[model samples]
Structure formats: structure tokens, C-alpha cells
Target: MVSMRSALRTAPALAALLLVLTGCGDSGPAAYGTDDRTITVDHGEKFTLKVPANPELGQNWYLASPRADAGVLKYRGDREDTGDGDGTQFFDFTALSRGKATVKLLFCPYGRCHSADEVASKPVPTATGTPKDSDQEAAYYLYTITVR
Candidate 1:
């Protein structure tokens, strides 16, 4: 059995404990992935993607802006066997549409291929929309990535 005074004394401590367990302060928006290979952007916002100028099949990377014609992105490899990142390639999108856009991390094959050249790609998770910013109508998006 607990006395009234003892219960009262532990009340504040219990409250603090609950807060810690539940997490204090703003947690921001819900994250999109279990890993750090995420990419996100807003309409009219600029973003950058870095990929090895040369990568083998099954190698994983990021791609963005597949739906919009002006912002479509792709990757290409070096012509020769240059081991250096001298083959490092980048596909950046300066202007994207203002809505939910789907992006794919693709396995773009190199070398001479057919007009029906095959490329494997997977859908990368994303949630894009225009958020109210000040008085102006603008697209807003936030993306987080971690590299080991």
C-alpha cells in the first residue's frame, strides 16, 4: 500500500518518465524509410543526386523526376574502364511539378544496346506536395539521407 504523501511525491517523477518514453518536443513529419537511401524534393525546388559514373548491375542508387518531361533524370557510365570516380555522374532536377511525384532508382545498363535496350528499375518511396509558405504559393519538400 502507498501513502497519499508518497503518491504525491512520485507524481511529478512519473509524469517526467512518461514524457521521456513518449519522446519530448516535435518529432517533425513521419520518415519514409528504414534505411538512409531516400530522396525527396518539392516543385520548383532544386535538388542534386550523386552516382558513380560507372556502376555494375545490381548496384543500387537514386533517381528522381520520372513523371515530368522537363525534369526527367537518368545515369550513364564511362566509355572506358576508368576505375576513378572520374566517371562520377550527376542528374539534377531544377524544376519539378507541384504534386505527388513518383521516382525510381534504376539499373541503367551501359554499352551498346538495342532500341529495345532493357533497364531494371524500382519505385522509390516519396510524398511530395506544396506546403503553405508565407503568402506565396510554393512547393515544399524535405528529404533526409544517411551514407555510411
Candidate 2:
């Protein structure tokens, strides 16, 4: 019957629509991503690199003002876990070179470089001082990085 055929076709269409709408769940680390790529950032003062909770594949991210010689900053996370929302993770790079700093983020696992499209940068401040420290200066710098 034409009705039966139409019903079958509609079912498949609806199923496809659901999948598209929901999108493939992020099974990897809660890295910054819009669809498939991943993103990481450097908060400036500390070498501890930061990454967005949900990273999309094949997107761009940055760590502002990275050391000219400093290599890519890496992040590790549980593969089987994803949470209610993206959570930020930080890593320390205190001993590394200091100055305007940016960190490189790869698309794949580990430090694998994936071209200019897969990295993000953030500026690292020279120092972070507390108000209680009389020697602390009020000067500070800001940097921005994005991961699509």
C-alpha cells in the first residue's frame, strides 16, 4: 500500500533528522570544540594551559603571546567521559620561557600538529601579584584565543 511505503520513508527521514539535530556526542576529552576540532589556551601569567570543555574537530584556537621558542602545550583527559557542560582544565608552564606567550593546540590526540587551523593562543602576563604584597604592581596584560 502507498501509505505503508510513505510511512517507511518518513521514518527514515525522521531518524536522520534526529541524528543531525542531536549531533554526534563528544566521546573524547571535554576539550573546546564546535563540531570536531579541539582548542587550548594559556591564561598568561602561568604556563598552565587551558582548554575549553567541548572542542570541535577541525577548528581554530589560540594562546596569545607565546614564547617564540616554546613548543606546543598538551592536555590529557579521560576518553570515555563527557559532562553536563564543558569544564576548563589548566596546566602549569611556570619554568618555561616568559613574555608575550601563546600555546599550540592540535586537532588529534597528544601534541600532533594539525596546521594553523587547529591552534589557539592567549597572552601570558609577566606576573600575578596579590594586593597584600606591597611590591606588587598594578600593571597587567590581556590576551584572547578562540577554538572553533
Top of the candidates by TM-score: 1
lDDT of 2: 0.34
lDDT score for residue 137 of model 1: 17
lDDT of 1 by residue, 31-144 (tens): 232122455544455444443434442223334333334333212321223355434434344434544433343323343221111322433223243111111211112333
RMSD of each: 16.3, 16.4
Q: Write down the worst ten-residue block by lDDT for model 1.
A: 131-140
Q: Which stretches of model 1 miss by more than 4 angstroms?
A: 1-37, 55-86, 108-116, 120-148
Give lDDT tens digits, candidate 2, residues 41-114: 33332233443323332222233323233433222222322245443433334323223333333222223333
TM-score for candidate 2 = 0.24
Q: For each predicted model, how many residue pairs clash, with residues at least 3 apart or on different chains?
A: 1, 39
TM-score of 1: 0.31
Q: How many clashing pairs in candidate 1?
A: 1
Range of the 10 consecutive residues with the lowest summed lDDT in candidate 2: 134-143
